[model samples]
Each structure stands twice: as C-alpha cells, then as structure tokens.
Target: MEPMDKDRRVPDRYEPGEGCLTTAVRLPVRIVVLVLVVPVRLVWDALAALGRAAHRTVLRPLGGGLAWLWRTLVVLPVAWTWRTLVVAPLGWLWRTLVVAPLGWLWRTLAVAPAVWLWRYVLTPVGRGIAWLVRGLGVALVWLGKALFVWPWVALWRYVLAPVGRGIGAVVAWLVRYLVVVPARWLYAHVLTPLGRGIAWLVRGLGTVLATLVRWIVVVPLVALWRHVLVPSGRVLAVVVTVVVREVGAAFGHCWRVAGIISRAVGRFLGTVLRWLFVEPVRWVYRTVLTPLGHGIRDGIWRPVRQALRTARETVRQTRRELRRALFGAPREPQPAAAVPPRREPGAPGTRTLGSSTTALTKD
Candidate 1:
C-alpha cells in the first residue's frame, strides 16, 4: 500500500459533508413554511379586518337610523294622538255630562225624598207598627202563660202526682222481685261455679304446658348444649389448635428458607429480564420508536392539528360575519330608569259613585 493510504487514523468509508446535509435540509423547510404559513396568516388577518370594517361601516349606521325613524314616525305620534283626541276628551265629557248631572239628580230626587219620607210618613208609621206589635206580643205571651200554667197546675195536682207515685211504687216492686233477686241468685250459683271451674282448668293447662316445655323443648335443648354441642366444640377447638400450632411451626421453619429462595430467584429473573426484555425494549424505544413518534407528531399530527384549528377559527369568523350581514350584531339592552308612580288627582282613598250608593243602601 502507498504511504498516505496506510494511515490507520483514516477511514475507508465515504463520509457525508456537513454543509451539504444542512443546506439540503434547511431549504425545503424554509420553502414549505413560506408557502403554507404565510398565506394562511395573511388570509386570517384579511378576514378579521373585513369583519371589523363591515360592522363599523354598514350595520351600525343602519340600526341607529331605523331606531330613530321608528321613534319619530310611530311612537311619538301615537302617544300624542291618543292623549289629545281620545283619552282627555272622553274623560272631560264623562265628568261634565254624566257624573255631575247624575250626582245632582241623585241628591235632589232620591236623597231628598228619602229623607222626607223617613222624617214624616215612615217614622210615624214605624212607631205605630212597633207599638201594635209590642201589644200583640204582650197579649200572646200572657195568653200562653195563662194557658200553660192552668193546665200544668191542674194536671199535677189532680192527675200526674197521684198516678206517678202509684206507678213508681209498682216499678220498684217489679224491679226488686224480677231483677235484683234473680241477678243475685244467678251470680251466686251459676257464674261463681263456672268461674271456679274455668280457673281450675286454666291452672291445669298451664301446668301441663310447663311440663311439656321442660320435657320436650327445654330438656332437649339443654341436653344438646351440655352433651353434644359442648363436646363437639371442645374437640373442634383442640383439633384447630393442633392444626394451627403445627402450621405455625412449619411456616416458621420454612419462612427464612422461602425468603432466601425467593430473593435468589427474583434476582435471577430480574437480571434475565433486564438482558432479554428490558434492555432490548429500552434500546428499541430510544433508537427507533422515540424518533418515529417524534417524526409523526411533529411532521404529520402538528400540521393536521394546526390546519384543524385554522379551519375552526375560519368557520367561527364566517358564521359571525353571516349573522352580522343578516341580523346585524346584537345590541345589549340598556337598563331602564325606574319611573316614580303617578298619583291621580282625588284617587287615593276616594270613593266612587257606586261605593257611595252602596253606603246609602247600607245605612
């Protein structure tokens, strides 16, 4: 070999130039960013500007002019015409033609006649009628009292008192003979024996029930608890105790041995996994999967996500613009100033004609 080619420091494989690789990578990235990002940014800015211009120029002025025209042409004229032509004239005519004349006529024709009739004819006639009624009531009461007392006194003295005494004596004799003596005899002979026999039967039944309970239910339960259940429980407890003690001793002996074996096995398994599974997985993730994931995220997912965001923003802007073009931007309603209530003249606590008429009728 030649002297220059025999140098061990030099490699025989072709090595790529750093400048060429950098240029190749950077030019395409710059061109792609200019082509995609710049035009999208420009379009977004232009749409925003157009939306702002339309709102300020066309929609605002039209809304204001329409509001002004409505107030001037419809609202004001209607209010003024209703008040001047209808409400005020009708109220004045009602007061002048209907209310005043009716009030005067009522006072003159109805009130005067009523007062005069009450003072002259009605008062005298009522007094006379009252006197007549009082005389008639007094006569009736006197007649009723006389009629009631005479008959009652006569009947009591002659008929009722003697008859009632004889009847009462007979009733007493009947009750003493028929009811009292029979009740006493029956209670003493029949009811008392029946009650005694019932009490004896009840005592005997209770004693038998007690004996049956002791022999059948209570004795069996006591024998089972004393003889069978106690012995079985004791044997079960002894067996369980022996089993627990043997198990505990065996577990104690095996615990350290098991722990040692498990630790050795775990260490061996961990080393083998690290060499066979863990280390290979780590290398693959670091070298292949991580780079691939980064490439997919940065190159494909990032652009798709950015494009979706742009589309969403554009759709929102278009919808807003369309709504503005059709219905105009919504105006926030201003809070109305609170108006103090207007009190009408002579309205508060003032009675109408109908109420006055009701008062007269009541009186």
Candidate 2:
C-alpha cells in the first residue's frame, strides 16, 4: 500500500485508461453530439441565410414592388376613375342639370314674379288699403266728435240752461231778499258806526305817534345834521373840487400838447406818403388798371353776359312753347255763381213768405 502522504497529495497527470475512461466514453458521445449539432446548426444557419437572402433579394423587393404596382395601377386608377366617372360627373350633373335649372326656374318663374307682384300690385293695394283705413279713422273721429258734442248741446239747449236760469233767478231772489237786506241793515247800523269809531281811534294814535317821533328823534337828528355835519361836508366837498380842478387842468394841458405833436407828425407822414407812394399808385390804378378792367369787361364779360342772357331767353321760350304744346291753352275763367240777396228781417216779401209757409204747415 502507498504511504498516507501519497494518498493526500494530488496527482498532476491523469492516466487515460485508469481515471479518464468515462471521459473517453463521453468524448465519443460529445463527438457524436458535435457532429449532429454542427450539422443541424449549419443547416439552420444556411436556412436562415437563405431566408434572409430570399427576403432581401426576392421577397422584400417583390412586396415593395407589388405594393408600388398596386398603388400605381389599381389605387391611382380606381381613385381617378371614381373621381372622374362618378364623383365629378355626378357633382357636375347635380349642379348643372338639377340645381342650376331649379335656381333659374325659382328666380324667373316664382321669385321674380313674386317680387313684381309685391312691388307693383300688392304694395299699391296695401297703400290704398292704408289710405282707406286712415280715411275711415278720420270719419270715425268726426262721428265721435259729433257724438261727444251732441249731448252737451242738448243739455245746454233743452235741460241745463233752462234749469240753470231758473236756479239762478231763485238764488238771486233769495240773495236779494234775505242776505242783501240783512247785510245792508248791518252795514248801515252796526258796521258803519264801528268802522267810524275804529278809524277815529287809529287816526288819533297815528297823530300822537307822529308828533312824538317828530319832537323826540327826527327834530334832534335834523338839527344835528344841519348844524354840524353839513358845514363839514361842504368844506370837504370844496377842497376836493379845487384839487380835482387843478389836476384836471394839468392833464388837459398835457393832452393838448400831445395831440398837437401827434397831429403834426401824422400830417407830415401823410403828405410824404401821399406824394411818394399813394399818388403814384392811385394814378396807375386809375389810368392803367381801370382801363384794362373796362376793356376786359367790354371784350369778354359783356359778350359772356349777352350769351347767357340769350341762352336764358331761349330756355324760357322753349319752356313756354313746351308748356303751351303739352298742356292746351289756358281756359277763360267762368263767372262765379250769383249770390242770393239777403232779405231784411222785416221785409214785406220775407214776411209774406214766412206767413204763407206757417199757414200751409198749420193747414
């Protein structure tokens, strides 16, 4: 047997037959597995490569091309056919044949006639109806006015006036008999005496007050103002008047001197300007400008005025001719109907007629 140390030590080299029998056996299996797996993997990889090649070279391009073909040939044509044959024609036909004719017919046959009828016939008829209604309203207003006035007239003429006169006469008689007699008696006896007594008392009191005011207040005030204040006011007024007069004299002398200087300067300036500028300008205007203006007026403005007058006369004559031609000549005025003469109230003929009518009615 080997030593224990040998048993504990790990061996560096393994023997093929002693300890690697299972590895050798597994090696065959591994080789077999490698063989099978490599072939299968190779087949799978080849198949995948073939599929990718087919997709890239054939299928993808075929699908894209087919899609493009379908889009170009089928989709575009179908869309074009639908739009051109169906949509466009149907829309155009609907608009042109149906909608246009219907619109035209509605406008010409229905709408235009309706507008005409409303404008010409219905509008005039409506205006006439409104006018008639207004006239009826006016007539009704007049009837209402008559109805409103009739009762007042009847009441005044038949009932109220007569009753009011009778009442007034009764009231007058009562007032005269009862109130007036008593009032006159009171005035004559009591009121007159009382009024006289009151007047006498008032006059006496007024006289006493006037005398007292005159003696106590008014006379003293008058005396004080006359004796003291009036003299002082007169002295002050005299002083003020003297001062005002002196100042006014000085101002007037200064004003006169200033006026004389201003007038002299103004006269000198006026003489210089008139001789230098004003007289020349005035001469030019009178000689050259006035003659030119007169020549223009005679040559241009006078002719224009004459033409305008002739045109106005022609227009007036044309207007008169048109008026005479369109409307016939004016008719002569007819004499007015003769007015009936008014009969005097007590005329013999009027009395006879009235009496004969009365007799006829009575018979």
Candidate 3:
C-alpha cells in the first residue's frame, strides 16, 4: 500500500484551461441556458403572434360597428345643420348689415367727429396753448434780445477796446525795452537751441520708425520666401493663396447673408407694423363707418349737449336761489308805506297845497 501511494503522482493544482473540472462546470451551464432560454423565447414569440392575430380579428368588427353607429347618429345631423344654417346666415348677414354699415359709418363718423372735436374743443385749447406759448416765446425773445443784442455788444466793445489799448501799449513798451538787445539774444541762443532740438528729435523718430518697419514688415516677408517659398515651391504659395481667397470668400458670403437677414428683419418689422396699425384701421373704416357715425352722434354728441343743457338749468336755478336769498322771496308782499308813490312827481297831491301852514323849514 505504501509503495502504491509513493508510486502514484499527486494530482496537480486545478487550472481552468487544462482541467476537466472547469469543462464539467461550463458544459452544463451552456446546455441549461440553451435549453431554458430557447424554449422561453419561442413561447414568447408564439404568444406575441397569437395576441396580434386575436387583436386584429377582434378590433376590426368593433371599429366597423363604431364607425357605422357614428355615421348613423352623430355625423349626419351635424353635417346637415352646418350646411343649412351657419354658412348661409353668415353670408347673408355680412352682405346686408355688416359690410354696408361699416362702410357708411366709417366714411361719415371718422372724419366728422375728429374734425368737429378739433373745431370745438381742441382748436380752442390749441389756440389758447399757442397764445400762451407765443406769449412765453415773446418774453423769451425779449429777454434774449435784452441779454445778447446791445449789452453783450457794448460789453465786448468795452473789453476789446481796453485789451487792444493795453496790448498796443505793451507792444510799444516791449519795443522800447527789448528791441535791440533781448530780441537778438533770443534769436541767437534760445531759438537756435529749440530748432536744433526739434530737428534732432524728428530725425531720431524717423530712424526708429524705419528700423521698426524693416524688422516687422520686411523680415517676415524674407523669412516667408526663404522657408515657405523655397521649400515647398509653388504648391505652398498656391495653397496659401487658395486658403486666403477661401477665407475672404467665406467672409464675403457671411456679410451677404447678414445683410439679407437684416433686410428680411426690417421687412418683417415693416409688415408687422402695417398689419397692426394701418391694415386694421383700413378694415375698420371699410366695415363699420355708418354705425360708428351714428354711435358718435348719439353716444357722444347727444350726451355732451344734454350735459350742457343740464348745466345751464343748474346755473339758472342757482341764480334764482341767490337772488331770493340776497333780496326777498318773490311771493312776499311789501307794506303800503314802504311802497313808492304811484302818481307822477309833476302832479299835485290829493290834499290841498299849503293846507297845514306848519312846516319844518322855511326858505
């Protein structure tokens, strides 16, 4: 037994690629999956087909019955009513009432009311405003004339006369003080130095600008010729030119597209404005002129006149109340003594003249 055990080699550690155990584990799993998954998929497919077939068979008759019922009950009456009533009445009413009244009213009402209102209310108000404005304008013009016309001219002459005299005096003084010595000294020393400095600065700047131009603009051209032109020869030049041209063309196309878009936006805005303001006004005038005219006459003019009449009545009532309050009520009577004489002053009294002889004063 010991020799048999020694003679038998111990089994090597299990390796997946080289082991039978792994094959045993994998084979059953694959077989199980194939067995289970295939049947499940087939059943699912069969059930789907059966469900679709049943749905088609059942739904067709149901749809047909529903359509037939709808045709019999709902559609027929609605179709008949629409054809008989709505379309015909709209056309007749539009022809008789809507279009005709609109045209007449707009023609009469639009211009007349605006013109009348302008004449009555707005014209007075505008004239008053214009008068007020003109008064203010005249005041401003008077003020401006006062401020600028004579005063400024006199002030300018006064100031300029003194300045001119002073300048002339200063020039005379300067000629007396500096003509011989100081003028010659300034020209010889100061002006010579200033002119030389200006010339030197200008020449320096010109030299620096020339150097910068040579370095920045000329060096790049030389390098391009040496590296790009010589190495790639004509192809590089052609490719660069083509690229630049394509870029320019693209820029031009973008500009054109932008211009077209801008024009389209402008036109769209113009069209929208026309539709919103102008076309609607035109349609309204065309449609409802007579009705609008009647409405204005009845609605606005009548009410305004009625209001003015009511105001006048109120004013008369107020005046009567004021008179009664200030004086006395008209129904109240006066005493006989308080009343004035009924006979003329030239007529004698009923009693005899100088009958009593007792008088308060003698003349």
lDDT leader: 1
Clashing pairs in 3: 102-287, 102-288, 102-289, 104-289, 104-290, 105-289, 105-290, 106-289, 106-290
Estimated TM-score for each candidate? 0.37, 0.31, 0.26
CA lDDT, every model vs. true structure: 0.76, 0.75, 0.72
Indicate the TM-score of model 3. 0.26
**What C-alpha lDDT does candidate 3 achieve relative to the native structure?**
0.72
> In terms of lDDT, which candidate is stronger, 1 or 2?
1
State the lDDT of candidate 1 residue by residue for 159-188, as single tens digits: 999999999999999999999999999999
The digit string of per-residue lDDT tens for model 2 on 296-320 reads 9999999999999999999999999
User: Across residues 185-279, which tens digit of lDDT does each residue of candidate 3 receive?
Assistant: 98999999999999999999999999999999999999998988788877667566655644454444334443344445546766998999999
Better of 1 and 3 by TM-score: 1
Cα misplacement distance, residue 362 of candidate 3 (Å): 99
Model 1 residue runs over 4 Å out of place are 1-84, 202-363
Task: Return whichever of 1 and 3 wins on lDDT.
Answer: 1
